[model samples]
Target: MVQLSLPLKWVALAVYFGTMSTSVLAFPQYQSLAGLSERELKEALPKLTPRLPTPPPRPEVYQGAKLVDDAAHPWRAPRAGDQRGPCPGLNTLANHGYLPRDGVASPAQIIAASMAGFNMDLQGASIATYVGHLLDGNLVTDLVSIGGKTPKTGPDPPGNGLVSGIRTHGTFEGDASITRGDDYFGDNFNFNQQLFDQLKDYMNRYGNGYYNLTVAREIRYQRIKQSIATNPTFELVGHRHFTAFGEAVFSTNMWVDGRVKGPLENHVTQEAAEAFFKNMRYPRGFFRASKPGSATNDQLQFVLGTDSSRPGHFPGKNVNGTNSFTIDHSQGSVADFCAFYTYFVGTRIKNLYPNPTGVLRRNLIINIEYFYGSRPPGIECTKVYPYGQL
Candidate 1:
């Protein structure tokens, strides 16, 4: 090669040395271009380490009374031994001398005596009309229709009798006849007469006059007791003694819708009645707000009539001067008029809101009445029963 200039030779030497030094420092065998250790390289590299997701928040805890879970209902199979008979409210009534003091008093006798204490008889004419409707064949026909079976002339098996239909009616309607009827029978008389006429017609069409009065009465008594024993209100009654507070709400002359008659026909609207019944749960804020020493205003227990009647607020239907069977307000002397009353009261009290604190709230009683043949406008009946009234 030709001889190189001085600067060119120096440049060639410098390039050769730079390349050698870079190779020695780079640590190529370790896959490190920066001459770093494994730990240093890892630290210098952009880290993509895996991580767990953040957890969600917890649910708020209720501080007031404990709720009765689905399994705690008294009527559920294998009922607790303490769950028999009327709730503790009945016993409390006996203890306070409002009812019979005899230890041997049956629930039926106690209920009868309680009705008598109000100057009302279970066999009064109003009650009798309701009883007649129950015994009438129309109720059975309605049940048979609902069951998709033809009405048979004779009774079938014991459990498959006309009572089965009544039970279905109670279940399908959420036992609303107990409370909503108060508005109808307590206020509307013409509607009540219309209901009675319909019942008579139903009886004439389907009644065979074969059902025994004594048997029917006993069945009614048992059914009423069972309804009371299994109600959520009855459970609340067990937790608190209401009589100590000297409070009670007596709702009179309630009625149910006639068979084949509902809201569409301007009779007790089936939809309205069902909606009212479905909403019979314990009042809102009852648990969290009803603790003893708390200033919460609670509801009073209800005693209402359970007779069938025409719709209280009928729309697009003419019910004036109609012969619908309403609570027989005419039968003033005999308790027959009052029989339906007892049933209604019994069922209503059976459905009180559950007591979260296992104690009754005090100073709350709401009596829904026609007072002057009409409910006072804008007044709402409280849903909670006083702790002690069963």
Candidate 2:
């Protein structure tokens, strides 16, 4: 080799030393820097960018349980053309004379017919005890004191007291002493007795003994209907529909019962009642307790009827206004006589039936009349002049 200048020699020494230092630090535990060639040193040294650590075999992302759709689940919306009108069951009953073919009947008439069919009695001796036990034992004492007059009782009894000599028929005709009956009576008597006991205990313990008279009447009829309306062939007469109605009625009664010791007392507001009614559901063709808050794809579209908001009406007044009635009533004084009868007769066709495809079926008309009132007046007749007009 030729002799090199001093500066060039120094530069070559520095380069050699720097390369050696890098190799020595690259892997301290393994080979020496002096043992490796330049190419080998370059291969052995650590990368400045660190080779990204081989990316740690990317972990898989976890997904939750997959959803599965089923028949009962995901509440399918109602379909188009699913809504219907008044049930056809009413016509069937009319043809059989179980109800009037004219489609006109009063609540009293309906009550009478149902009573006759079932052999129930409202005026029987047990009624006083039953009614008294519903509100208070004192009520029985008061009734007996006043010669069979319904006692002015409740959280706030009516000023006029009960219409004298009027009593409500229970669902069963059994003697209170009897424990059971042959068919529905066995269960029904127990059910009614339990209901009475529960109501009495509730009123005595938690409520003010004041019953909501109008609501009580409604409950009585509802209970009666529930007990009697169980003919499989009869559309309106089914356990399911009656059960639903009874539930609604019971709920309302409980609501009123709660108010007995609270702020509202027997004065359940119409707004409140309507709200409760709006939320009620029943079998097909029966009334929906309330207007549906929302619409679904399969919801039936039908008119309930005109909302009658008369201020001075009997039940309406009791619920919305200051007027209150005692448990007693002369038969003709109750305004809902026609409305109730018509509702029972008209809504008979809404019984639940099997669908061929097993899909949800729609009721024809919304049975709002039970909660509100009936339309077209259940019965209307004009006097005719046989000879000359008077």
Q: Candidate 2's residue-wise lDDT over 39-82, tens digit each?
A: 54344333212111111111112211111112212222223322
lDDT of 1 by residue, 256-348 (tens): 111223322212223322221222212221111111110001211111122222221111111232322122222121112133233332343
Error of model 1, residue 327, in angstroms: 7.3
Candidate 1 residues lying further than 4 Å off, grouped into runs, are 1-64, 70-155, 158-327, 330-390
- Candidate 1: C-alpha RMSD after superposition: 32.0
Per-model TM values vs. the true structure: 0.18, 0.18
Reference-based TM-score, model 2? 0.18
Model 2 stretches with alpha carbons more than 4 Å out: 1-194, 205-390
Question: Which candidate ranks first by lDDT, i.e. highest?
Answer: 2
**Per-residue lDDT value at 179 in model 2:** 15
